[model samples]
Structures are given as structure tokens and as C-alpha cells.
Target: MNTATPWITGVRQICLAVEDCDATIRRYYDQVGIGPWAVWTPKLTNTKIRGKTQPYSLRVAMAWTGDFMWEVVQPLEGPSIFREFLDEHGEGVHHVLVETGTEDFDQVLAEATARGLPPIMEGSWEETDFAYLQSEHALKTNIEVLRRSPIFKGRPEPDYYYPFPPPQDSPE
Candidate 1:
């Protein structure tokens, strides 16, 4: 007695990791050129992936583009997605996000699984309804011409790369 939910939305943003966040921002603000601040969250970084050289001081930048927003993420330290891109591509466009419309995120997740698109995170965001398809599966989606952008831009770009001096309290 299970029912499946349907889609009701599309991509809202595509995040990318850059080498020089300021430079990247200027390029868009000065080059591609868009507009006057819509809404942006403060720098919220501080996630590390151990055994990496993230610099622990990254930044995330975003701006409106046409009908969607272009987000740029600059990793501060360790070997984050940003660093991965810099090491290979040297900074640029990243992944495209398809906003979930169906409330039955679980249904969608199941669908993706059926399609061989297993997920990585499902704690809350990747629940039964809203989930991200592995990079390979995203490409195979065949929904559009280009394959899914890549896994680099799936997550939101943080404001800072790492936490400062550690929180006042640690698990005691």
C-alpha cells in the first residue's frame, strides 16, 4: 500500500569551487555581471575531511544569474572538493542542483535507487524524498543533454573552511 510522489520543481543553483574566491566573485561581479544582492548566508564553514590540506579558510560566494543563482565555494584548507578542482581544473563551474518538489522525498530516493543511483548522504537532506544522485548517475539521468555536472557542487559552499580555535567546549 505504498504510493510514489511526483516532481514539482527544477534546478535552483549550481555550486562551484574556486581557487581564489575574491577573483571568482569579481569575475562574475565584473565579467559575467549580474546584480544587487538578493540574499546570501554568512560564511558557515568548518568541516574537515581529515588528512587534507584545506588551508582551513575557504569562502562561499553566490549571485543571481538569469533565473538561477551561481554559487562559488572556496575551500580554506585540507583536500576538499575545492582543492580537488583546483588541483585539476584550476577553478570553475561545478554541479547543478535539481530542487525537490515532491514531498515524498523517500519515493524519489527509492526511484533513484531503482535506477542504480545510490546516494551518499541521507541523514536529513538525503531522506526518502530529497536526495542527490551519485555523479555518474546524475549524468545518466538523460533528462538533459549534458550529464550531471559532477559531485563537486552538491553541497552548499561554506563561508569559512574551518572552525576558529575550536568551540569553547568539546565533548567532555
Candidate 2:
């Protein structure tokens, strides 16, 4: 059903969620050989879900794995559907967001809605217009991906920080 360029751009970033960002980053950092990562956490944003006010912070550790950016996220102080995902399953790949270019950002979102893919997530407010909609078959996937504004393209490649080492003694 996806013929026209659905969003502003194309598939740009891939995100993963982990129970332990430090260990996961370390795994990619040491074991996986992905390094030089960057850590970013967004401030709390208020979103309405099921007619209730929800607050949440988008916490994540991002790194470039070859061409795609691998993001590990943890929901801090909020009621994120992502958190609900953890409760249902576990931390893992959440979403595959396709960058919709900046121009006619509103049109992209409107198109999604008009085309019948109401966005589960957007870059900013509902009025700003630019946003992304999750796939109709998202529930049957390994993760959930939401795209942001396409202003940032060719996101600098990140590094995997996993440099495998000795096994630390477990805390007893």
C-alpha cells in the first residue's frame, strides 16, 4: 500500500531499547565494535492518551552502526506507550522512522491521515503539522518506529562502543 513517498524522506534511523543502556552501549562499544556514541534525553512532553494526560522524557543513547544510527531508549518519568511496550515484552527494537523532508511537513502528515495512516508520534505539537504515522501492521512487528522532522538528514554515522573484555564477577 506504500507506493508514494509516505513521509518527508525515506527510512533514515533505526532505534533499539535496552534494559541497561550502559551495558548495551558497552556491548556495542566493546563486544560489537560500535563506538563514539552520543547520549541524549528529551525533556518531559505532555501527551494525551485514552483521554488522560501523560508525561514522559525520551531518554536514549545513540550511536552510528555503519550507516544507520542505533538508538537505545529508556522512558524516564512519563507514561509512554514505549514503557507499556516494555511491560508487554522487553526492551528491544521499537520503531523504524522514515525521515519526511521539511518542506510541506504538514502535507506529509495530512497525507498520512488522508491516506489513512494516522501518526502514533510526531516531532512537535499537533499543530506544527510535520509528523509521522506508524504502519498499520505495526503491532505484528519486532519493534515500533516513529519518524521525526526531516530537517536533520545524513545524520552523522555513529560508532559501536562494544570492545569485548573480561566478564565482571556478578553481584551476589
Candidate 3:
């Protein structure tokens, strides 16, 4: 495997955009036996789209199925890439997340941006920083770059059900 990109270690998660969060989660559990998922509304403090700040919320459910993590995203409110995917493609795999080291985070981000894949969504939670690159045209799916501080150990245990915010009108 080409390891020119030293920052990127491997695939961390695969994200899907779904219309109904509950139904999708239930279906995955029944059909694929993937969950007991942990559902939560990601609180993105400083999100950007096309390099401009945009407010958005996503109702996301995550589960670890063997080696990789799987994520289901339901666009809850505001202008988001998940909403755009749902609008354009209905429902399908939206992105693939890659793990990067915190030490090389800036270089990785700079390289992605220089290659014309600007971030559509980016935020930092505790010690982890994540950015979703808008590379669907070239790569067929968005690329999410994640870098977590060494202090950040792992995700919380899966939760059965987490209350999500009510849906809101899409941004104009």
C-alpha cells in the first residue's frame, strides 16, 4: 500500500445518510446485526461549509461492527452535507472517515485543501478534531479526516436511545 500520506493511518468509519434515523438503525440491527447503536446529536461548535461558518446539527448513530465503525446520519437541522446528500441521492453511503495523527493534522488538512477538497464540515470536540472534505465529484464520497489527541482514549459505550432535536427547515 502506498504510504506517502503518513498522516492517514487507515479507514476509521463509514458514514451513511438515511432519511429515518430510527428506522434505519432498527433495520441495520435486524438485517445486519450491527447494533445496539449509540445515538447522539453532534454539537459542532464551529462548523464551516465551503470555508464559511454554517450552523447545522446531525442526529447520528454509531456502532462498532468488527474492525471498523459504522455511522448513520440524519440531518436534523440547518444546512449540512448530510442534508445535501439526502436531497440529491436520497439515502446511501455518504463518507469514509480516515484516522490521522494529531501531530500531522495540519499538514494533512493543508494537503487536502491544496488538492481542492475543501472542508464542508469541521469541528473539534474535546481532544478530537474532524473535517469532512467535499470530494464527492472526484472520490464518489466525502472524506472525513479525524485527528485525536493522545489523551482522548475512546468512545463511550453504546446507548440504546438518545433523544434528538426536532427537525427544522433547511437553510435558504
Q: How do these models rank on lDDT, best leading?
A: 3, 2, 1
Tell me, by lDDT, which candidate is best: 3
Q: Name the runs in model 3 displaced over 4 angstroms.
A: 1-8, 101-103, 156-172
Lowest-sum lDDT 10-residue window in model 1: 121-130
Show pairs that collide, candidate 3.
none
lDDT of 2 by residue, 1-172 (tens): 2436534356656667566677777777777676555655543343543335555566566665456666677777656656766877787776665655563545555566676566564333222222325552644532222334446343232222233321333110
Lowest summed lDDT across 10 adjacent residues in model 2 is found at 163-172
lDDT tens digits, residue span 1-172, model 1: 1235434258776766676666666656566554322222333232223322223434555555556766666767444444655686766655565655533455555565565555532212111122335443356321211122224334343333221221323210
Q: Model 1 scores what on Cα lDDT?
A: 0.45
Rank by TM-score, highest first: 3, 2, 1
Runs in model 1 with CA error above 4 Å? 1-8, 37-58, 105-110, 120-132, 136-172
lDDT of each structure? 0.45, 0.53, 0.76
CA displacement after TM-score superposition, residue 57 of candidate 2 (Å): 1.2
**How would you encode candidate 3's per-residue C-alpha lDDT over 1-172 as one tens digit per residue?**
1235555667978999998988998888888777657787756676777778888887888766666788999998889888889899999999999876554777777777777777878876657788998799998999998777889865433334523221232110
